[model samples]
Target: MTPSIMSLFMNSAFLAMEAQQVVWLRMMRVAAGGASADRELSRMATEKMQAAIQLGTAATLAAVGGNSSERIAANAIRGYRSRVRANRRRLTK
Candidate 1:
């Protein structure tokens, strides 16, 4: 990949982490008498869960495939999933 693309991917990964943090914070707010946050948190969590399932499935397909389409789709999903794996590697300051 080009350096520019790599940098963009890095930025996107950080953005995704921020989005996840926001979702968690919203959940906390909902717990602390912020009922309005519930709908948003629920929506965000549902979307994230669906995405995670798709990524996990694609990763699994990449792990075990007999034909070509599965492998191709897996590779494409893996590219997207790399950002997710990056988000998991949080830094402590």
Candidate 2:
């Protein structure tokens, strides 16, 4: 065969191989989507629960009256703030 004809054939063969590879990659992505989706849902649920707990803690702090118990509530709020900072660092990393 002429060099030009052989080069064209080789290029066509490479294109077909690439197309097949792309199809397989898409199929694999679809197959793995189920587990990844489940993991994402679980992550979202955990974050929501954490937010709820933080809100509840804030509500407890607000519920304290203007008495001696205020000191204890203030301490709890400080602890909650520390926990929030730690969680932020953990999540950001």
Q: Please report, as a residue range, the 10-residue window in candidate 1 with the lowest summed lDDT.
A: 84-93
Across 1-93, the per-residue lDDT of candidate 1 in tens digits comes to: 223455556665666676576546655666766655666567657757877787777767755765354444435445555644543343111
lDDT by residue for model 2 (1-93), tens: 123445545555654565455445445544677975466457546865886687567656656643344444444444444544544444335
- Measured over all alpha carbons after superposition, the RMSD of each candidate to the real structure, in angstroms, is 8.7, 25.3
Q: Model 1: C-alpha RMSD to truth? A: 8.7
The pairs that clash in candidate 2 are none
Report the lDDT of model 2 for residue 27. 52
TM-scores of the candidates in the order shown: 0.38, 0.32
Model 1 regions lying over 4 Å from their true place: 1-36, 66-93
Task: Give model 2's TM-score versus the native structure.
Answer: 0.32
